[model samples]
Target: MMPTIVFGVLSVIIIGFALAMVLSKNLVHSAIFMAATFVGVAGIYLTLSAGFLAAVQILIYVGAISILMVFGVMLTRRGDISASNLFNKRIISGVVVSAALFIILGRLILTSEWFPSSFSVPESTVGPIADLMMNAYVIPFETAALILLAAMVGAIILAKGARRTR
Candidate 1:
């Protein structure tokens, strides 16, 4: 009973945040909403008993990726918030393509065969994943983190260097 309620709440959060992210005009607000959506997804993963995936979602998406997006938006933003997210000339074409894809997906789903799914995912996935990350893959993980940090630093430097002269 409680799990169901929790799942419902997480689902609502995810949907709301995703909508806010997409519709937000302010880039920073959109990035923050995206981060919130990622957090909501982590909560859903928790409800599914995938603790490791939930943690990774929080760390990678919410923490690292969202921060990167927020920084990129902030650094590159030139005009006022109201001027952001304007409809492009391709809006009509984009809408038409999106509607066509949606209709195709709807038809595929409605016509798909539903078999009673009996799939088994190994319960000990987290154990082996942790073992590999901590032991054999530690250096690679650290190297990746170092590369991300260097990339972020380089981005900041480049953005600052391109500042227009008055």
Candidate 2:
């Protein structure tokens, strides 16, 4: 009952924010809407008892990616943050392709057997997963973090260089 209500609310939030993110003219506003969409996805994960996924959604998507995008928009001196032309001459073709793809995917989804007849939800916990990440996957995790750090530093340098020229 409560889960259903939560799911419905989060679904609405996710869809609304996703649409807003896509439709928003201002880049910053779009980033904010994207963050909201991430949060809504995290909420959905929580309702589904996927604690690790929820946390990752919040931390990685909302916290890191969204912040990086917002910073990128703010630091760059572009012509206009708000896009003037929302659609191009190829919009008709794009829409046709999108609709066809959607129909194909929808048909596949409706026909596929997602789970076995005797399938049961397995119990999950975050503790063992965290332990494994910190132990077995530590090197890979650290490497990824370093890569992100390098990208951020590069972005900062580019922004500073651009600022000096202007």
- Measured by TM-score, how close is model 2 to the native structure? 0.69
Candidate RMSDs in Å, in order, are 4.7, 3.9
Q: Write the per-residue lDDT of candidate 1 for residues 1-166, one digit (tens) a residue.
A: 9998998999899989997887777778888999999999999988777788999999999999999988887876887966577655676788799889989998999999989548666677599787888899999988999999999999888877878542
Best by TM-score: 2
Each model's TM-score, in the order given?
A: 0.63, 0.69
Give the runs in model 1 whose Cα sits over 4 Å from its true position.
Answer: 1-12, 87-89, 114-125, 131-166
Question: What are the Cα lDDT values of the candidates?
Answer: 0.86, 0.85
Error of 2 at 28 (Å): 2.0
- Which residue window of length 10 is worst by lDDT in model 1? 116-125
Candidate 2, residue 76: the lDDT equals 59
- What does the lDDT come to for candidate 1? 0.86
Per lDDT, the best of the predicted structures is 1
Q: Write the per-residue lDDT of candidate 2 for residues 1-166, one digit (tens) a residue.
A: 9888989999999989987887677778989999999999999888767788899999999999999988977875467767732555676787799889989999999999887457443477577678878999999989999999999999899978987998
